[model samples]
Target: MAMDEIIPPPEVDLPRETEDSERIIPSPDVEYLPRQTEDTERKLPSPEVDYLSRQNEDILEQKEEHGKTTELERKEKQLKEERHGEEHERPHEELGQGTKLETQCEEHKRLERQCEELERQRRKLERQGEELKRMKTITIVYEQFRQWIEDKASNSSSGVSFIEFNPSEVDDSVPKDQNHCLGRGGYGIVYKAKLRNETVAMKILNESSRQGEREFKQEIAILKRIRHQNLITLRGACSEKFALMYELLPNGTLEDRLINEKQRESFSWEERVRVATSICTALVFLHNAKPNPIAHGDLKPGNILFDDENICKLSDFGISRLLQQTNDTGTPNHITEVPKGSGPYMDPEFKNTGKLTPQSDVFALGIILLQLVTGQSATGLRKHIVDKLEGKKLEKMDTRKQKMILEKLQILDAQLKLDDTSIQDAVKMVSLGLRCSNSERKRRPSLEIEVWPEIESMNKSECLYGSDEVD
Candidate 1:
């Protein structure tokens, strides 16, 4: 063989075709792609990665944009969670504030109520303090009265005694006969009784009358301290039975005499004037009483008593009041929320103002004076006199006019026939009565200065006239 043929004939080793090797082979029709440049990376993003070579770039750009979008979404979710947490906490904080405000309002209401209760308690204490002071004054007055009674009993040399009797002894002395009963008053019955072997009058309080017992004690105290010829004399007293023994007056009360036709017929104008003067004197004594001035709250014909000699006396000091001295004017007065007195004789000023003064007694006396002179009912007597005297110039009138005025006044009592002097006296008394009963208290004349002087002058004139006639 030739040398070249001999070399070809020698065995050469060749690689075998496998699956991985077959995959590495490229088709002849496919185009080749190059790596991305820096300038191409900086250019605007393209669709589909600018074809094959741009495909790899497009994939890389998409992965980068997806990463950035995920980061932004995570941050937005975190922000949303924080806002939701704040929204949930806000309502609880507002509820806490509202509860605090309600509690404050309730506390304020409780404080206001407490303040009101304290104010009420303060007022109650003030009222109680006033009551206690009044009771203390009453106790002092009672002690003084008791001491006076004891002193009188110890100093007395007469057979009269101030011993308190038992109820059985008082009852045994009293007569049960209706004929023995002298009179019946608001508080008790007056009866003829035998006490200590002496005939005496007994005033026995009704069992139901608690006020009568107080009045009885008051009467005893007043009688023991005061002595008057015209006043009834207290003989003895039974405290246990609420009974009082007194010297009986046979003539009875002024009311009984005034109402009786026979007695009224015999009651002369001169006698009426005397009676009026006597009552005025008694009132003066009562008004000037020591320690305090007294006001007889009830003054009526029934409370005026007469002796067999026709002498008048005032009685029944049950409703009497002791006036206190005022600091501002040093005038004696009794100031109260309500004033008590008989309606017809009540002082106009005292009724309206609740202040009892000496003028109050003067007003009552005026009514009594008018009743004595005219023998008319006291209810409308003052007004009748006022109406008749309203426009008349009494001081300036002539004698004829004065006579006509007197006729028009209708003040003369139909039961009595009066003389010229008595008629003139009646006119004078009516004038004085009208003056005293003036609605304005300041206009009323003073009893000591004007009333008593006029009465005394009239009495003196009558006595002088009688003396001249006798001579």
Candidate 2:
């Protein structure tokens, strides 16, 4: 070397980029890529390269013993393992080790939860199986019970397995119509059914064929519970394939006579008053009855029937409910879905709010009294009769209209306005009718001693025993 000359290097230096070239070059040893790629990565050695180098031999030996490829060879071999795990494992590995560990832990927990869920489902299936077995047992028991009852009935009825417990089968020897067909209805068609000579009103429900049987059975149950001279009683029942019989009401129904112009003409004012009084008594009984207080449900003149003694009785308990005095009554505007009685006789309180107070029955009674005295349904009365009576007639009119015309002669005395008749008696009775017709239920007096005493005194003054004839 010359005294002033520097020593030359053994290796050649590579060119470096600068502002002039404005470019970066990659060495042959590395695979270069752009900065951005959602899922691209490059493998790098750990910072502790010396420690890794020392362990490399052991790791290599372990891989070889396990028949796995060396690290350098692994890349080529892994690429060839395309079919089994790479689609899943490669993506996971690219995501970073921290994410992979968390994902793996979550997967382990999910599998464990799945196993627990499967166990719970198996237990639920076992419980359902037991329930099915119990249901099967219950069905068998019910069948056995029915069989036993049928057998007992077969033995008791003189070899006739199903002797209909019907009132219509009174005397099998008589003509079918004359013998009282179980399913009888209306005035002329009514059957005089006999249960051992005790007659019953055998009216088959006439409205809907579907409702006939149900209505008959319901009527029977209602009549059976009631034992009154005033109320048409149900003596016995006979239920068959959509057929029924009731204890016959020999005198027929007030509705039948009232609706008929000629028959209603025979009704006297005295008889009308008597009928009205009897019905009020019946209502009192029903309202005060124990266990389940009834509200006639449908108290139309037609549903009213007379006995041979010319006495009236209230009948018909269908579409009725047992009044349950519950705490819920405190709510001012509560209503039950169930409806009450015939439309006209139905109380206004029952219309707005389903609270059934005794005043409701009183309201209906007031209308009945008016109908009896006027001898016609309120609808057919004089021009603005309701208004003429200070709107009292409208509020007092029963929603139920009589099928027959009212007795015209009953009000003859009042219409005549005889000088001997002070007319005070008629006015007082009419006032009672108006009081019953009050729209506000609370305004109407309950059917207590004070309410009926006024009317009863009038009947006695006319030599009537609560509107009954002295004879």
Candidate 3:
């Protein structure tokens, strides 16, 4: 402690970069480390020194803790940024993929719908093509028939007249207009036409088979010669197309009237009796022809038609055969290999023997009679009638028809002054029908001898009950 003597500064301990005698130098702008004065070091008490040392240690520990906390906060912020980026990118990718999938689905559905539509159109076109092909074939067939007819007409010199018909006149379009096609059958197709101030049904044969061509020629020949009130009248014919024009029957066929319940309601008992009588009359005329008796090969309800006046007319003589007459007797001989008649109404005897006679026609008439009695199909009626004849109950006959007929008869008895004779005549007629339809050809009754008498008796009863009542 000499007065005015200079003392050197004490050395300050500072952090070093390495332990190998290397002290860290601070930058010129940085403050130097703090150092205690000699007088303060000498005067300071032990407790005070200890307190300052503890304070320094506390400051150092506080600085270290603050640095560690800052580092932790920075790391946490970096992790959050990375997570946020990843979440944002994943949503964008998922959204893009979902959009692509939805677009693909929409496109697929649209294509499927278009494919289905195309398939439907293809099927419709195929059907149309088939129909066109059929028309073309028919047109070609008509042209062939026309040529044959022209040649025959030129050579024969027989007073037979036939009009030339253009095949184009009849087409698919002909069937679409008003009063179009009237009907079609196995032999020919019929169309409704308005011809020269008259409505006529034009029947054109397909002539696809040999049988059909033969029938076309035979029908024309048969219709030209025969003329009767019950027989259908021929208007004209086109030999070229094998088409024949006939008087139009607006009331349709007898089969339609009998089979259709709605039409049957309008057909009264008197009408049925009249129809039967007319058919019998026609058969009688055919069976007893001038030179040779013409056997109508097909006799069924379908062959019978009704005019505008509801008059019954027999038609379709395609399979009619002109029987040969034996020189010894004027009796008609059987025709062998005759074409079979319509099903149900055809005679089984004729089918077995291949012989067509007028008796075969009677068998069909018997079935028609059964149809008038019972509102059931004329087909398979023979079995039902035989069942009834065997003393068994009519299992197949409609019970509803019995009630309807009985009720109708009761009404007729009251209104038309009919008696038990009418009922007896009906029952007798049914009995006659059964005998006429007998499976044994010999057992079956003749249309002229046995059937005519019974039908005339029924007709008499109808007349007695007042024939004017039906008209």
| Winner on lDDT (1 vs 2) | 1
Q: After superposing candidate 2, which stretches have Cα over 4 Å from the reference?
A: 1-190, 194-198, 205-221, 241-245, 256-265, 328-335, 338-340, 354-357, 380-383, 390-422, 461-471
For candidate 3, lDDT tens digit of each residue in 161-269?
3344465553322455644777778776788875555567888776653356677778777777766667887867766677777878788888897777778777777
Clashing pairs in 1: 49-54
Off by over 4 Å in 3: 1-179, 207-211, 327-331, 392-419, 460-471
Candidate 3: residue 177 Cα off by (Å): 2.4
lDDT (tens digit, per residue) of candidate 2 on 194-311 = 5444445444444544345546555555556545445654544456533334445567777766667776777765566567666765665666555656666556676677777777
Q: 454, model 2: CA deviation in Å?
A: 2.5
Q: Compute each candidate's TM-score over C-alphas.
A: 0.60, 0.50, 0.56
Tell me the whole-model lDDT of each prediction, alpha carbons only: 0.72, 0.54, 0.69
Q: lDDT per residue, candidate 1, 88-189, as tens digits?
A: 887888888989999999999999999899989999987777555434333333343345457756876533545566788897988878999988877688
Candidate 1 has a TM-score of: 0.60
Cα RMSD, each candidate: 19.7, 26.6, 25.1
In terms of TM-score, the best-performing candidate is: 1
